[model samples]
Target chain A: MNSLSLSIIGFGNVGRGVAEVLYTKMPHFKKKYGINIKVVSITDTSATIWDQEAINLREAIETKNHFGSLKFWGNEYEVYKLDPMEVVKEIDADVIIDVTNDKNASKWHLEALKRGKGVVTSNKPPVVFDYKELVDLANSKNLPYLFEATVMAGTPIINLLKEEILADSVKRISGVFNGTTTFILTSIETGMTFKEALKQAQTAGIAERDPSNDLKGIDAAYKATILHHLAFYPIDFKEVHIEGIENLSEEEIREAKKEGTPFRLVATVEEGKVEIKPKKVYENGPLAVSGTSNVAVIETDLLGELMLKGSGAGIKETASGVVGDIIRAAVSIYKYL
Target chain B: MNSLSLSIIGFGNVGRGVAEVLYTKMPHFKKKYGINIKVVSITDTSATIWDQEAINLREAIETKNHFGSLKFWGNEYEVYKLDPMEVVKEIDADVIIDVTNDKNASKWHLEALKRGKGVVTSNKPPVVFDYKELVDLANSKNLPYLFEATVMAGTPIINLLKEEILADSVKRISGVFNGTTTFILTSIETGMTFKEALKQAQTAGIAERDPSNDLKGIDAAYKATILHHLAFYPIDFKEVHIEGIENLSEEEIREAKKEGTPFRLVATVEEGKVEIKPKKVYENGPLAVSGTSNVAVIETDLLGELMLKGSGAGIKETASGVVGDIIRAAVSIYKYL
Candidate 1:
């Protein structure tokens, strides 16, 4: 049986989550998918741990959880303070799993694809900002550059669009793309101040410490831009019109509620235009997703309207998507007799 | 660029719809997917037209719609008065698309798979009754056996479950699998008697001429059985417990409505059990899909709960799903370098 080697970049929550899933689901993956996955290298901002032989993933996970870095590894491992590009160039791996939130990681992804390595990532920068270049590079190389966790986490929006609905022409896509903004908006709808809702979301780990991208519609814009590129057109991220929830007033929310519409931060891509704005939606409409849930309503000529709803963000959810993409990439590699 | 060949095994509404899609989406498929798909053979109950150089799909669709048969073609095709198995064995094609309602089509599917041809189907019997055998044969031969239209038409449930959510453990699946029954049930809810609702559904073409399968819960049971096999356990169709709306009186429906619960023909599969019963669901619950819409609520351990909703049945919708599966099969064949 052939085994696939994986080098993970950024051992953060998503990276460790993939490691945990790969560790726990090893037997199932080998038994069912007939593909063995080995973590050969794992790199973070501080250190990069590489081993020609498979790394001790369990100890590495524990080391990262305890010491917050890969520095606690024993001397048996070769540790180097290498950047993402250096590791991408040097790693002897079949696939590069990019879970880094670094904005500059798109260069590393392109480098990896150019090196004939399959790329699976939960990172949004490469896909949202550099979709055409990365996708063209991957297509030119006949490699898989999958990012199922980038939009809607493990909800499988990208896979659904590309693989399942391949023959249908998607006319428009509108949905709740940002979970943090949706959480805040839903909390505000329940009579909480915007500040209180934001604090609660941050306390619940839904919002990050530096949550400018999430709060100011940049995150939603990135998702909308990615979806637009995949579904309809290859509209750039900067080209998408964006409006955050900061300008939405409580009086407007109350007024909309009285008129039978509820406020929701919706990301819409249609007719060569993409935008993320806080709009009033009908109460029972598909876009009126509450809480931290995300939903995408895709309109197609053949399939009419299709809606997919699921948990937008979680460690296990995003990891499930990334690992699923790993299996898909592996299957694509070994599909033939 | 290898072009794939298809042999369709029906010329009814769905078959014509598939031809229409193939004719219109040919350029899109060639440009986007980089594959050419040709309909090599088309068979109906009356006649079989086999053309080695590929049939004029537009003309075939026009013939089916205008004259209702392939008799209009004057000797440009090989016409035979043969059974489906003969056609399956004789047709030199890469894939067999079964869109017939023939109960004995499973034998033809088995023969086609045994002959090493990929099978894409909208027909349900072959999947409902002989899923294990057909799937095992396809797997043993490494050929594709896709039936995305069998359960939810163009909704992409099967792909979502098998491919996208492959890494997650699907705990349970509950859904409204039969669109005709749902349409009838919704009609009954809107101040119509059971017979009146069934008549209305038949008049609206939502219910078939012989709607026993739709009314007696057989359709939902078959879908539940298929979903159970795909999601959890491979429970046989006979093993699934079924309860139809024929037994539920108008008084019971009114009583349930008074109690704030709406009657829905829910197909539920959980913990080694599958059942399609007329249960009273909450007004706005996940399983409360109105009219002809189909919704599947999949409970997975990793991604928590996921819901997918779309049009469950239509000529173009089901054809879109079948064509999508055909593209998927073609892509799988061409994935490896």
Candidate 2:
């Protein structure tokens, strides 16, 4: 059996969600790829647990969910009050999974890549801020740094760009890249104020408590920047011109609907320029994704227009992307091993 | 530098289209993957050309287009009067590219897989009829048998299934799998009879000379069978219940339109059962693709629902799928090497 060690740097919903999947699907993965994966360490913002022996993933998830830390998981673990990067270096793992939604995870990602650890991340900071540097490091080390969950959760956007559409040049990409904003906008379309819609989204667990990043279009801009790097060229997140839906009125949305259109938080990358803003879209067009659904329409030269739509955010969907990347990295490791 | 020798079977539109892409995108592929691919042999239905050295692909495409044979291009090639299976054994190549549109290539695909050659095909018969045998042969040999072009051309349907959605259990797959039938149906919606729409499709280069398979829903059934094998379990093509668009009248289409629905030849696979039939679809549903476009909506347990849409079939689109598979095979080969 080809066994690989894994360390997850977040005990949040997505982090625990991936742990849950890896625990349940471990046998399936092993049977499919001859890959036996064991989670050895988990680091959250507050505490880090390291066990050279395999951690009891079920206990870890349960403890984390109930007590907000893996330290209370009945004492088969060593808790370290250390930084995420320190825990990353200390853990002797083959792959590091970063589900931490923080800018500090960027440095840890680079550190993991530098230490020849394959990294699967759902966070977007590392990719948007240091795409060229981190990707170059991963390539230079022949390590996989996959963030399939960053853009559209597990909807297969990055894999589509990297694997399937290599023969065709993508000319334009436009879609609702942010599901929280999309949910908010759709709520506004039904006569809710922006504040009420955002509260509703938060209550529905679609929007984060601190959803300023989503409302200000920073999340979409970061996703667009990532897409730009993967599909077109390397570009900084700051370079992407952004316009948020924070200021849009219900009256404005109603007018668009009355005119037979709907306001969508459209992220467009055309001719190397990236923009994420609200725009009126045709009712039946590809970008008219409803609720919290994320959609991307890529106009390619040879294959014409391709659209991908799916659940953009949620614990299970994001965990699916992270686990997919882990398996992908493991398969690649299997090939090269 | 990693290099591989390629052999192409069936010098028809899709074969020639792949050749054109391979010729034009050589530098790009080489630069990206360090893969130097050369077409060493090409076989049409009537003739086969064996060149120990790399044949000039441009001249070969032109010769096949003008004179209907590669023999007219030069005398430096060896002409083989052998069957495709014999040629598969004779060829010293890494991969066999099958673009033939006949059941004869099914034997060739099995033979190539048995001979330890990676087979990348746009042909659907081998996959539909002898899917289990061919796939088992390829798997046991640890060789790739990629037929991404068989379904939705270069729209990345198979890659999405194989690589991206590994974590989710797919419950249902519904799609507009055939572009010719989609075009014909949409034309019928515009007040044309099925015969007139098929003629218009032929003139528009969307329908083939003998489109009985497409009209009788065999093509869509084949694609759905392929999808079933990829996404769900293995089932024979004959197991799919098929109902084609051959008998649909203008009045039926008009009635559907009046009922605020469109007639789409939907390929549906649910709970190990397959159905390909012309059915009424909601205007904005995933299967309600129009005008030579293909769409697939996969319902998964974890990822919720995912929809993929793109150009279903065309020379360039199918060629993109073929080349994508070639590159994918080469990358896998590179890792193993």
Residue A100's lDDT within candidate 1 is: 89
Point out where model 2 deviates above 4 Å.
A75-78, A335-337, B74-83, B335-337
lDDT by residue (B80-149, candidate 2, tens digit) is 7755777799978899998988786788888888788999999998888888888889989989999999
The list of candidate 1 runs beyond 4 A from truth reads A74-78, A334-337, B72-79, B333-337
Predicted structure with the largest DockQ when compared to the true one: 1
CAPRI rating of model 2 = medium
Tens digit of per-residue lDDT, candidate 2, span A1-337 = 7678898988889998999999998887887767888888888877777787888899888888899776675764577786788877887999999998888677888888888799999989888888898888998999999999998998889888887776787889888889888888888888888889888988998888999999899999999889999887798666789999978878998899778788888999986699988999998777888877998999987898898999888889999899989988888887666
DockQ of each: 0.79, 0.75
Chain B, candidate 1: TM-score: 0.96
lDDT of 1 at B314: 91
> A1-337 in candidate 1: lDDT tens per residue?
8878889998999999999998998898888888888888999888999887888889999989988889777766778887788889987888999998988888999889988898999999888888899999998988989999999999999899887887799899999988898888778777888888889999999999888898889998988888988887687676789899888887787678677798888888897899889899998788878777899999999999999999889899999899999998888776531
